[model samples]
Target: MSVRELVVLGSASAVPTRTRNHNGYLLRWDGRGLLFDPGEGTQRQMAHAGVSAHDVDWICVTHFHGDHCLGVPGVVQRIARDGVAHPVDAAFPASGTEYWRRLRHAAVFRDTDVIRERPITGAAARLDTGDAPFTLTARRLSHPVEAYGYRLEEPDGVTMLRGELAARGIQGPLVRRLQQEGRVVAPDGRTVTREECSVPRPGQKVAFVMDTGLCDAVHELAAEVDLLVIESTFLAEDSALASEYGHLTAAQAGRVAADCGVRRLVLTHISERYGAEDEPRFAEQAAAAYSGDIVLVQDLDRVDVPPRRRAR
Candidate 1:
């Protein structure tokens, strides 16, 4: 069975509090894992989340801020230390090439040669994931530093309708043949098309937006996605500070989710100033803007992507 969920390794912003860790998120899609914006304590946080270096197939860095990419050294070291057999790909802003190199070799550890660096530049760049089920792309976001958001799109597929299939007496290997060929010959020599027995299913989409102020790319990447994991570093009361630091408030994040038709919105990268008591305020402010489901993330929290929408 395939598992799909978001494992919140850490959700704190610039500073980690006693209850929250630094920024980190592991998106588990089917059998593959994509780790995003791993900060200082990601290595230990992964262990606590019951995930290992082997689970990480892709590392996406939104920016080089300490709260975003500080854990690269430890994560790279652990990937080498565990001798993970699969090749791990790392994507980040091309302008941060020097930072990427320094972090990869930050320490004098034996290199296992497992990581593949794919530096992203320009307004939008597609990362090559040869033969992967989904396509991954990065789009520039409006951050003080060079930053980018990530989006994943799966190809559209067809879902079999049991009622239609049974009505046509199609079953067993004939069902598979119908799916594979899009048409199957009936015993009466009639040509039955896949459309008669299946419904078109829209592909699943996910977006990761962090450390960005309001921008067109933010809306573009988030448009109609099933799940959007984004940074909400401040409450509405701190709108000025959020604007100065190029971060989003809970209300802004929620508005984006509502405007983009996001099904589930995950609010993370919470400021250190907010404590357990203030968590509810984030949800409340976001609720005031978006009617969709909103999740205020916590360390080690797992949120599953809601069921895929199918054509009626």
Candidate 2:
């Protein structure tokens, strides 16, 4: 069976607390692993989480913020060290190309051409993930520096009705033909259509919203997604500070989730001020708006993407 889960390597914000390291999340989708916002100490945190550099198929940087991307050099070096044969694609703000170049060669280490640079140029655009299972897109976010949010949308497919297939005496390769071609000829010289035997199954979607204030792009990226991993750098009580720093409050994250019809809201980029005792309050504040699942992520925690919704 395929595995789909978000591994939280580090969940702290600009500053690292005693427990929280920095912002790093590994989203494992089937055979691919997307590493997002590898902040300081992410190399160590990944080791602690039992994640190796070989597992990262893509590196997605929200911005050039130290807390969001300081560990790029280490992760890149490690990828080269491990001699990962697969090409690793990286996406970040086009404006930060210089910063990325510096980070890529931060130290004297063996470099490999396996790392491919894919910088975002427009305000909103589709990313080139190359024959991946899903379509990845990026949208500009409201932040002091150039930042972008990413969303992955899988194409919709049909869910074969087992009862209908059995009634039609379809099995084995015949079933595969029906699924692939949308129609198959039965042994009785009759035609079986996909619509007659299956329901439309909406494919799963996942979005990442990091280090941004409330914005239309935020909701647009998160619209109807199965999982939304967003930044909640402050509580509602500090809304002024949050607005000034271009970061979302827990309540804002919750409101976004509710407005976007998100299935699960995984809140990260938590401010260092909030300790273990205050972590529960993040969920409480988010619950004030969204009724769906909420997760105040902890270091090394793993949040599984919810199962696909029933076909309509």
Candidate 3:
């Protein structure tokens, strides 16, 4: 069975308290896995979340902040330790090439996986992995540094209609031939077009935004996404602090979701000040702003992507 879910490894913003770890998330989309913003202790956190280095197909870093990328060296070393033969593409801000290089060589082990440094330079650029089911798009976000958000879009599929199949008396070999050729002729002297029989199955989309203050780019990155994983580093009461630090409050993240028409909103990168008791208040604040499903993410929590919106 195929699966699409965000396995939250750690959700704390800057410093990790006893209750929370630093920022890290594992996106399991179909057969591929993408690791985003792996902060300290992510290697262990992955094990805690039932995620392995073998499962990671991509490592996407939004910026060079310690809380966003401190775990890269460890993760890279562990991937080598695990002996994963397949390549794992690493995407980050091209401006932070030095930081990524330091992390890439922090500690040396036998390099087994093909780790490619795919950097993002501007507002929008596509990362074509050549074999993955989805294509990645990186968009510039509003942060102090050259931060960017990542989006994944799967290829659209063609769904054939059963009624059209019977109407054309097309079966077995002819049906397969039509699917391959895009058109076929029936024995009854009728021509069947692929468009007449098949409907376009809209592709699934996931967006990841972190370490950015509330901005128009936030809405643009998350527009019409099936799942949006965003940072909510403060409560609504501390929104001022959030803005000063170039971060988002729970309410602000919710408001972006409400405005962008996102199907599911996941609130992460929490401040350590908030306890379990304090989470409800933030949730309530975000809920007030966002009508769609809201998730107050924690360490090891898994949030599933909602089904695609039916075609109008």
Model 1, 136: alpha-carbon shift in Å?
0.9
lDDT of 2 by residue, 1-312 (tens): 898899999998999999888899999988899999999999999999999999999999999999999999999999999999998999999999999999989999888889999999788989888888888899999999999999988899989999999898888999999999989998887899988899999999999999988899999999999999999999889999999999999999999999999999999998988768888999999999999999988899999999999998
lDDT of 3 by residue, 1-312 (tens): 899999998989889978789999999988899999999999999988888999999999999999999999999998898888789999999999999999988975776647988988978889976888898888888888889998888877677788889888988898888888998998898888888887887788899999998777788889888899998889988878888889888888888888888889898888888888898876788888899898887799999989765643
Over 119-175, each residue of candidate 1 has an lDDT whose tens digit, in order, gives 999999999988778999999999989999999988898999999888888889999
Ranking of all candidate structures by their TM-score, best first: 2, 1, 3
Cα lDDT over the full model 1: 0.93
| lDDT, model 2 | 0.93
Per-residue lDDT for 282 in model 2? 94
Segments in model 2 whose C-alpha atoms lie over 4 Å from true places: none
RMSD of 3: 1.7
Query: Residue 93's C-alpha lDDT in candidate 2?
Result: 96
Against the true structure, candidate 2 reaches a TM-score of 0.98
